[model samples]
Target: MTASVLSRAGADLSTARESLARAAQRVEDLLGALPVPGLRSLEQRDRAAAAHNEVRAHRVDFMATHATEVYDELTGGRTRDLRLDELVEAAAGAFPGLVPTAGQLAVERSRAQADKEGREIDQGIFLRGVLRCDLAGPHLLTAMLRPTTRALLLLPDFQRTGLIEMEAVRLERRDGVARLTMCRQDCLNAEDERQVDDMETAVDLALLDPAVRVGLIRGGEMTHPRYQGRRVFSAGINLKKLSAGEIPLVGFLLRRELGYLHKIRRGLCPREPEQWHAPYLDKPWVGAIDTFAIGGGTQLALLFDHVIAASDAYFSLPAAREGIIPGVANLRFTRIAGARLSRQVILQGRRILATDPEAHLLVDEVVEPAAMDDAVERALTRLDGAAVVANRRMVNFAEESLADFRAYVGEFTVQQALRIYGEDVIDKVDRFSGRSE
Candidate 1:
């Protein structure tokens, strides 16, 4: 009976693979026949869009039905061992025109405008299909928690001197604490590709370091004229770069949530799978919100064990106005703040001042700007005990399980892609930048 069941499963896998391959070929042919987006008539573009949507719906259905089998086939049953980028590269190779190559993504980044005429949107849909798959989505997300190559390369030097300074982030170990500071001075420490890469590398260092018992995130002093010498937590996503099509969909949007942020919340996974349940290489993290935590920055504060905010500091998630999802905030906010307040903040662009009684949901303490340093030290000292790890794990498991996060990302994957390329994105960004007509 077991052999018979196995045989039927194999047959189903084979059928699904064949069906998807034929669908991919049809999509390729249909896209090839359509004129470039700039030259296509409205009716022609509409028809093409409909065809694209139909193919995506079919692909999503297949992925949902045969997720584990298809993913195992793609990864040679080694999905547990592969990194996120490796998995994505494998998918790109298998599907050819359906997914963007690393080089193709780089070319898109160099463009002044996002490619509405190409397969990039289709690629986003394809990725979304994979993420929406229950087992496969969480597996892929877990893969992203592994240490970055940059961090590994710099580990030896850091081990010797306990310091690392990159273009957008700096890290130093002292007194059982790993201090990771965001240093993109020009843009008030806004996150872009460079910032995310450097920050993730810094995060890997903090988690991988043997002597560190606690981690702290704070903004480095800024050089921007408006906030010169002041530490502005983060200005959030670099809208200027975003509007220029410099941020890749996978590299920034998905990578930030599944990569560094997830690592911070869940801790780093081991390179080799463990036979027994082992604690993730995690430590308590504290956020020092000196000036403001806006958008991505606010989303970040949600994951920290404790957050210390300046009395005058503020928090907001303007993702609705910005035409994008506020990185995992949707999944986390309702739990921290009640549903109504979460909606106000995320949907209505409401800002929460640190000193407000309601701000206690996100911030553990609010201190005078001059006393922020002392508040952070107190929080760190309080959290540096041995029991921090176990408590953090328990709270994380109870609040947001890996499965819950996976489901959220599944929806975010496709919805964010659409918003990123939506006509409204550029216009909204332009208005924010004072460049709109």
Candidate 2:
């Protein structure tokens, strides 16, 4: 990672510079008008610009410094005469990834490639020397297939983001066991649209990896704005970068490899024998979902069996909040909380207070912020042997008795979500965006 080579990669970035700027400007505008009583007068625009530029600056530094190391790995040769243009044509389709074939592949002899070779190749192609760190392995190996640490994780920060700071995942060692902690900032914690996606992808990949055991998540409130100044916009969420980086791949890998979801039997509804008992009667796992467990965050939490929650963790069926409801989340919530709690969860915009006794019904333990981490540790500590498993099975079988309580009469409601993103939503966006109609 030297200064000369990073300069070349930095050159490939002229195209994305402007996009980075607009995204930052829009964020500053929205933060200015937030409903917070004392925040109104704060000039966050400058800070936003600085943060945005910091990421961009890091990109320039990486390009000038790390480019040679990047190129050498991409276009290694017996002759140390490989030029940037030669490397581009040699590894065109896979300039930033790995070799199509395995070790010690031949390099394309020669070609005078164009300056902007981006359109000449597909985005998914591998570069000759990019290293993908193998987390599951005992020994560390770096090659052309993928990147390790900063190269893969911090590349975007170097490219689109303008700053770099410590982003070490907190690992606490207790009784020889290591637990990972995820922290949350009081305000929305995204720099640009690109990093938002990158961080999410990195977290998703890191957590689901079998190498990780218990994941401690504290805050996860990610929001994006379209514009600012006089008008405001909340175009919901932007799943582009996040999705592109393979967020869903984590879930797919979990189910395919782990058989993580254990299906539960629906008990008989006393009167309607064929009808399943309680709403969560026939789900794969048991867990509590609360406090804005909408979007990908909520979806991932459901993948776990025992969910610890805060009363304020408001869970919402955001499908309607968008434009559709595949009834996917319902497939689980209906059974666990039974029909009654499930109905209230979706049909009514309700916040299942974690402090409330009702939260304990869904989760194993419900405690205040200070005690939540302790409760999770206790749950894990006692899980060392077979007794916990035996008790879990016993409790699950007993849960079958609650199937009769799943019934309730009501239609699904979309008013709150609608209000959040309705004409008012568009108006706030357009007004701030200076695109008001």
Candidate 3:
């Protein structure tokens, strides 16, 4: 009886493998026929998008239904200690045209042109499919938390001096606090690839430091004529760079969420999967909002344990007008502000002022501009006294677990990609008049 059952199970495994192989072949054929070369014309783009969507639908369905089976096959039945990039490479080889290899994606990012839009869209769709696979989604997300190559190289210097200054960000560890200041003065402290890379490296420095008990993020003084010498929390995505096709979806959108912001919220994951459930190496983060937090800036405030804002400050997520999904705001805003208000804030581009009663949802303390420094110090002291790591871990476990984040990213990956390349977004970017908001 045991031999008969084993034989049946073996047959089923063989059948599933064969089905996957055939599906992969079908995807290869479809992609080969619909070669996404430049897509110069509207008609060409539309047709290519439709073809990509079909491929995406098929891939999503297969992964959703056979996530474990697919993962098992990719890893050769070894689930433990799997690296994310390795798994991605394996998938790219096994399922040609479904996903780009890491090297290919890197090359595309380096090019950063309108001509590469189709390939970028395909990469996003492929990531969405990967994120759907429960076995792989969380792994990929966790892998992003590891320090970047730049960060790793600078670690020794940071350890020696407790300060590292990059072009767009500066980090200093002092009195048990790792202070990260955004330094894109000319752009009103807006985020771009340079800023994001520097910011992530700074965050990595803070997390890796044993003496650091808390992390703080605040914008540096701006050089824009109107806001010259004054701090502006952040102007959000650098519209100029984004409109110029300098912002690749994977490098900026995906990396910002999966990398620094996530590191700030959940801390660093253990190298071993067995230890993931254990408490992460985390510290409470504080956001010091000076003038305003707009779009991606507002999204950043949501991840902090404590947010301190100047009485005259305000926050807004104008992603609706920008024609792209605000990074993870949809998943997070509703929880803080109720569904209705969150809708107003996100969908209607409503701005919440620091002095308003409703601002309490996003800001923990509102202080006069002159008193901001004192307020931040007091908040840090309070956080230091409390069991910050324990409390944060408990709160996150209840509010946004790894599984919850994984699912949200899985869906977000595809939606944001489509929005980024949509006609409406292109039109909006063309009409942008150099306004920070």
TM-scores, all models, native as reference? 0.92, 0.35, 0.85
Model 1: lDDT equals 0.81
Output the better candidate (2/3) by TM-score.
3
Error of 1 at 44 (Å): 2.9
Clashes of 2: 51
lDDT of 2 by residue, 369-419 (tens): 455556666655544344543454456567433222111100111122123
lDDT of 3: 0.78
Off by over 4 Å in 1: 1-19, 33-35, 96-98, 101-107, 118-124, 128-134, 271-277, 433-437
**Model 1 Cα lDDT, one tens digit per residue, 1-437:** 49999789989867776777677678658877877554677898898788777777766676667667767767677445455556667767765544667776665566644345444565566666667776666667767877888899999999889999999988999998999999889899889999988889999999988888999999999989989889999999998888777766677888888889999999998664661475477889999998899999999999999999999899999988998889889889988999999999999999999988899999988899999888889899999987878888889889898878887887777778778877778678867766555
Q: How close is candidate 2 to the true structure, as a TM-score?
A: 0.35
**Each model's C-alpha lDDT?**
0.81, 0.33, 0.78
Position 400, candidate 3: lDDT: 87
- Model 1 shows how many backbone clashes? 0
Candidate with the larger lDDT of 2 and 3: 3
Q: How much does each candidate deviate from the true structure in C-alpha RMSD? A: 2.5, 20.2, 4.1
Residue 363 alpha-carbon offset, candidate 1, angstroms: 1.0
Highest-scoring model, lDDT: 1
Candidate 3 residue-wise lDDT, 179-273, digit = tens: 99998887887788888889888998898787788999999888888988888889998877776677877778888888888888888764656
Candidate maximizing TM-score: 1
